[model samples]
Target: MITKPQFKSNDYKNGLYLVATPIGNLKDISFRSLEVLAKSDYILCEDTRVSKNLLEKYQIKSKLISNHKFNEKKNTLQIIEYLKSGKLISLISDAGTPSISDPGLVLVNECIRNNLNIFSIPGPSAVTTAVAASGFSDKFLFYGFLPEKKNQIEDEIKKLSNFNHCLVFFSSSKKLNKLIPAFKKFFTGRKIVFCRELSKLYEEYIRKNIDELELFNNELKGELTIVISEKKEEKASQKLSESDINLIKRMINKLTTKEITDLICTNKNIPKKVVYNFCLKLKNEI
Candidate 1:
């Protein structure tokens, strides 16, 4: 039998802690996560009632503050003030990691603006869990949860049409009827893995050709994580685009290679390594 791990009291810092709670199983919560919860001064939860179930299981009694979608904007100022005052604040979603598809983005942004330290406890995530289970290409663009409507979903797919990467996104069970067919029409011939209720008792995976996905007529439950493999013909780009080349040429004489790399990577659509190599080639000539 595997003995339960014990945790030492970490010198809790005065910063924002982003804790990742379990998506389904409570037992998956790590020793560090429990320690953070036990030690944090204020815990911002997406749902107090739901989070209480997890906290109670571990005997953690940290002060819980409501921070869901409905009230996040209203609470941002107060949360930032708490951080500024050197209070130990923890942000947690009801399940899984916070701020991926959850409501911690506002608080995080505010904390960033005020120059407060933010630490990630780094535990469970639906994106990584599903991707690991699917045996698909590791290179993926996780779009979090896509818009509900058909038109918006199509528009989003159209925007990402140029990039040939394994695509990851979340959707509700109701949208499976629309989502499967939309993906078929927009991204045909690709293989997709629809993981339903990951890390739970009823977890199911439906890996089928995108063209054949419409035939899945069974009622699906829990949240869905969809991963669409890249088309074989559309290889990942190695060379920079003409526009990126022009940008690099324009900035070559004006900035350091590292500075140019940072600017291009931050503002342009080019990859960092690609831009860095371009800078190196320019640096050699200089």
Candidate 2:
């Protein structure tokens, strides 16, 4: 906890200043972000407790307010009034860019509706960080985090079924057990990469295809950025291999749907329900 003041007070415009904080490593924060945060009249953050650590780090003496999921809508009106009164308000999330998958959108929109000046001091973004690491650096689509309900998740995946771009999703470790299965069902034949705990010391990247979805257990922990590539590129040989597919095809004739589903799930480490669905799809095709 090196607490020497790293920033000096500077004059920022009277509006909402969106400051990007570090995703994991505190040092990943930018100088401009520090300057904006230091100069603001007050700081609105997703979690005052989380932002407290950041503020304490730089000795950022600005006042802190809680503006997260629950209170954002209610607080937006007050924030709008604050901006109208010509005060520089800084908005930051627990980590990464504000409004990407966190609170700040409501406040930003409220500020916009009132024609208040909005400044974005961009820095760390898990979306771009994961995309940059993902090999499919072509056209990309960030779908934020998946909805919690099962039906909503299914509906969202169905809507994006024909999407050809690299689909990106921010999923929590808990929801991933269901979310990964959704990806398996909808994005078959696509290459998937799990960027876990990105930029953190325990950072991990697990890449696999929708078909070869075995062996990667849902026992994974930490924040996840799941990227599914559109088309199978020839850059690397298919790890699952054509021979594996041929064997599965051969088994399709001998094994019952349930038996085949059980075998694949056991072999691949995928969830039973997902493997069952995959087998049903495979059975329908042949």
Point out the worst 10-residue segment of candidate 1 by lDDT: 1-10
Residue-level lDDT for 91 in candidate 2 = 91
Off by over 4 Å in 1: 1-10, 234-286
Instruction: List model 2 lDDT by residue over 1-286, tens digit each.
Output: 5645455444566788889999888899987888888888889998888999988888889999998899899998888888889888999999898988899887777777788999999899888888888888568999998899988999999888777788899988777877767777888888888898888899988888787786445478877888888754334222434654566677888998788766665645455665556556778997
Against the reference, the lDDT scores of all candidates come to: 0.84, 0.81
> Using Cα atoms with residue i matched to residue i, what is each candidate's TM-score against the true structure?
0.77, 0.76
TM-score of 2: 0.76
Candidate 2: residue 64 Cα off by (Å): 0.4
Candidate 2 residues lying further than 4 Å off, grouped into runs, are: 1-11, 215-218, 232-286
